[model samples]
Target: MEGKTVFVDGALPGESVLMQYSSVRGKFDEGYVKEVLSRSADRVKPPCEFFEICGGCSLQHMSSEAQIEFKQSILKEHFEHFGNVQPETWLEPLQLDTLGYRKKARLGIRFVTKKDSCLVGFREKRSNFLAEIESCAVLMPKVSELIVPLRNLIGSMDAKQSTPQIELAAGDDALAFVVRHMEPLSEQDKEKWLNFAEENDIHLYFQPKGPDTVHKVWPNDNNDRLHYQLPDFDVELAFHPMDFTQVNTSVNRAMVSLAIDLLELNGEERVLDLFCGLGNFTIPLAKKSKAVIGVEGVDSMVKRGYENAKRNNLENVDFYQADLQQDFSEKEWAKEGFDKILIDPPRSGALDVVQYLPKFGASRVVYVSCNPSTLARDAGVLKEQGYRLVKAGVMDMFPHTAHVESIAVFERNN
Candidate 1:
């Protein structure tokens, strides 16, 4: 212990515990708590029965407040270490439901001949095998309740062994499940699935090939999309089952409100939103600003953004398609000066785009980041470009996991 570092899975800070080593390395060792001789006040008994084995959640052992504090410390450390700067104001941590908040998930499906049944849930921790779980604590109650019924439904199907996964998506008033089957489903299997959907009052879909092959199987309705609303902005977004949407509805709503407030947009200001999928922030910004431009890399999402704008009757917003990683200064949208900018890039961060933010002549920038390290690195770049980090804080978008979702606001140092 004196010569090397040890990473314990279940042990908390300031606690003595007996641990069993699972993996040994030259630089460090990995282990889990076998016995806790001493405990911290922050430690709590995980509410989920499958938390011990399920890989879905890692920080369930820590109290909810402690988890938020831990994430905040991580963000602070990243800012100090990578960016060499700190925000002037540390915002209050944004949080919502600690459990039953996740509205989307990709659950594993496994047919075990030994048990003569099918298993449906997340994979086991540190293993490739699926965990045998009947209910999930983090998923929405409607989706969690479908686990056992989904298992039984697959078990009764002729293609049980071929169905490998189920994709879940939920909205304010609708829930949908997409069954990914490797083989063809018999007419009887289809009927069974339809009956299950009808009884559960949920939409059912089938994916015999790829994501493009996913099609609704129940109710035979023309509408194949699920929607969520940002009631504060009077905006509603509709998306297909395969489309990427925020998993926590409340957190997303709160995050959007925070980002918009940080921008301090006036009716005369023009705003630009980068990586704006389905006009999540752009349309809302349009409601408060004079004009808004939404740019995305994917073609389908660009179309979806336009479709949503039309649905909301928002003529002040426009959607554009561009690879942010490349130079886009020549484009008409990029040439215009923006009063404020909102960036919600992927995990890789927006280094390629952030480096050029100063050229856009934006007075303010609000960045929503999923990765602290990348955010910190980009913050350093922004500092060099004469933008001062003003306010920053973590959001409990993912409650019981190590994932850190944070937002930072920067004002141009004019």
Candidate 2:
């Protein structure tokens, strides 16, 4: 490693420069600048002053257009290189707001004992230490602006010694700040958090340890649960902060629409929603189909799905709990068959379930993924099962970042 400036900040491919090795996790070992680099031609200067140090936005140093271009190309290359089957249509990537768009974030907090002060924000690139930040540009303005105040407020807290991090969550109009505290908040600390929320029109939550134990320091208006709307069918989805809701609500809606349209339900189709969480797409699909069975590995979420379906008056949707990777083909599974299917699993993709689909007799499978490589691998499996990749597309759920959310429709060959 040399003592030279490294262009680790969005250097194009083919350019070379002096960059130190970043030892941090999820960090590139070497960084370089793109002098004669031939990139996607949509490069731009990052808007943040701490662009190089902040670990939040790696692609922000690149242009937004290039980010989407790279995402689209990533899917394209995976299909060509791994799946070896081209999709009929590259459904345009669903793009959304660039800045102040993130609804959820987990920020780092460090007490600079030497300086006798506290620093609150994301960590720096290649460093375990926290980046002392005054504000963030990418997080929603409410949470972003709270960076400095949070530091000052926590610094004044009586229990600041036992605090490690703060999680920011904003749902619709409700703001929540869940503090990770090793020690309980004192009376003064609670007052400070209360005044901060009241003066700033924000809400504050605290976590003594795990997510299940998180509760509000002060009672909030429970009338407004964290909810988002499905505009297509005027359906509302109320989810807890711990629930798996996409931070980007706009792209989520587009994803649900695409999945439903691809399934092409005729109000008589039996749809199987696999790895479904809180009925993100199940209840809405229920409105258009004869019946839907939403299944998930987490029993709490399966219970939530049932509650959500009942709340929406969607009697056709039934939620079940099962481990798709293991017992998906148990003797009881044969009792239910699907004419169409929608799968929104985690980054592992739905390989295990796709392999089991052939036995149950499915007509179509709409796979939603946050990782493209796994999707391609599972696509290969579906292809072996006599399914054709009809259409595929990207959703810019996380703009100005490398996170890619994609969807593909697999239709059984006639």
Candidate 3:
């Protein structure tokens, strides 16, 4: 416990490890654990064979229960240190399956001529080179099983060297992959992809250039849109391969239920869902509230949100596209007073929108966040606006990694 600061990888607090200095900086030093002289009781054998090399997960060595506890501590530390406030009540930490929960990921692809093979998985830890992995334990079982086949599939193609990455998205009942290729695919390559898709019963899309250039190549029927359902509210949401959706469907369902409960929506109240991508929360809230307005920054997602609402046979929901970081006081939708609000902003948090909470006259606000630091910063702003933090808790949306998904409720002080 010297004054010198050392950031060690693969070592948790209170654990004695033999670490090799990796770098020496002016302010701090970096090291990697070479041997665990003493192990923590919470440490467990990592499930994935590639956990040592792959950078997909950091806390695989920590038990799932301990991981959740660590994350909860981090959330509490952030609130107290950054926000200068604490919740009156701490909600139970929400959790689900720890393994095979990742439904979305972008895997790096590399064709190593020296090995005369293709590598398909996450990048090596702390390096840009792709990790050599046969299979991934974190990906959905259906998608994880395809690692070896995918590597072989790409290795056999002439454009294998040109392919750089693969974006994976798995819904409740469907799986889609967007192959990013720098060069055009030959006819033979197309045939190989078609056979793979047919054999796997999965959809395939090709990204020749950018994300917008992605186009579906298989299942010409045009009916296989990726979707996830909320059986509780009878709401189904459809999204494109590149659309932003929660990686864990089970946790998402539970999260939505918790958020709605925190809102205390009474059917007669109007609600606002901000940063409402694909109307994941908007559609469900509409079922309980009299009317719900969903606002998104992306035009395509805003349109898709409205479509999702209509598909669910809900007419009490409306969606608008607007930059949430900018002022929307003059917008017609802003004039509609909302009794409750649900904000699910990106990692940057909802500073821009939180400023308008007082003016919206919402008695209750539910903030679902993915970044703890940003959430704490925004929480401070909410406190300044006469809202009292009623309850806050962490959601294990991402289990092994350091990502934190949290929900906090703030009620306007009477």
Candidate 4:
């Protein structure tokens, strides 16, 4: 204990200080330095009261500018090592409101009636105990307000001990909550949720299993047809709560703008959106391009995408269901040779699609990804296939949390 140094969350590198263990490794994996120890100049006081204790965000203590600089390095190192090429121009990283902007989250739920109260919140940094938060600063204000009521609701559950998690989804038309109960709910539990929904004007989804098993209890038709609007496109896309979407809606809107700008679209150009989910980039691209084809792996999502296109009166858009890992070169894809392409794959990034990217006949391609490591790998493939990495940058989609979202542009070498 005399010489061993424990890594502390708030203590920046090069700091030294005395410390005691408070389950330090899990929540943040270190002790608060009694002295300055060694600290990075970028260190700053976290804005949230629950910063260190809550498991939600790990980098709030770092300066906002520092966060971006470090993230940019992660992206650069990834592309340099994995993709083996650098971009012609590094586009400016997108930044949004650093606090109270998160619209989606999964909250840890617990009920301990012995304290004459119910405790529902996020898990402590490295412990199973709740953070005992009054509110969360990272969540949208509307969503954040539910924290207290959420605590009370868990206390009312018949099997309060069985409540494990709460999935909060806020939509344009309605608010829905998915309660992950580990055991059978009593009739009283159902009624409590019913009364809560009625009073708060929210919908309840009970998830006995996975997202697929989530069901509406009070309203037979619980889905209020939620969709996030694209900028000036006048397009609305319907998506389920479980679907993958950028957490910060404002940043997503800006990301769509950057992706569209980098694509350099013309009215004559047709674009391909690979790994498109509910046509996030696809529909928006259609606003400027001649037509857009969106390919996704999920059949149901593809069907919903087509329907959404119809609802928006965008007849030029096409939605196809295809395993992105399989060959996309066929008569179906060849007939519609794309002039521009937008790839917004999941955290795995667009690894397999990079090989087919150049062959798609696109002169320009814009890629948006959440994971830098995978993006780096695919960037290498793109560079090898004769596409030059034109521009790239990161987006702070989820602040406080270390998750990074980024956009890159690739153009075929003339």
Tens digit per residue, CA lDDT, model 2, 191-244 = 888898888876667789888888775447654246778889778877666567
lDDT (C-alpha) at residue 36 in model 4: 69
lDDT tens digits, residues 131-203, model 4? 8887888887866887888787777667788888888776656667788988888888888888888788777
The lDDT values for all models are 0.92, 0.79, 0.91, 0.79
How far is 357's C-alpha from truth in model 2 (Å)? Answer: 1.2
Give residue 359's lDDT in candidate 2 (0 to 100): 72
Model 1, span 1-414: residue lDDT tens = 778899999888999999999999999999999999999999999989999999999999999999999999999999999999899999999988999999999999999999998999998988999999999999998888878988998999999999999898998879998989998889999899889989998888999997889999887987898888999999998898889898999999999998999999878998999999898898889999999999999999999999899989999999999999788878899888888999999999999888999988999999999999999999999999999999999999989999999999999997
Weakest lDDT window of 10 consecutive positions for candidate 2: 19-28
What TM-score, over all chains together, does every model reach?
0.98, 0.91, 0.98, 0.90
Position 28, candidate 2: lDDT: 30
* lDDT tens per residue, model 3, 248-324: 98999999999999999779999999999899899999999999999999999998998898898999999998999
Model 4 stretches astray by more than 4 angstroms = 1-8, 13-35, 38-41, 113-117, 128-130, 218-223
Colliding pairs, model 3: none
lDDT of 1: 0.92
What are the root-mean-square deviations of the candidates from the true structure over C-alphas? 1.0, 3.6, 1.1, 3.5
Answer with 1 or 3, whichever has the higher lDDT.
1
Model 1 misplacement above 4 A: none
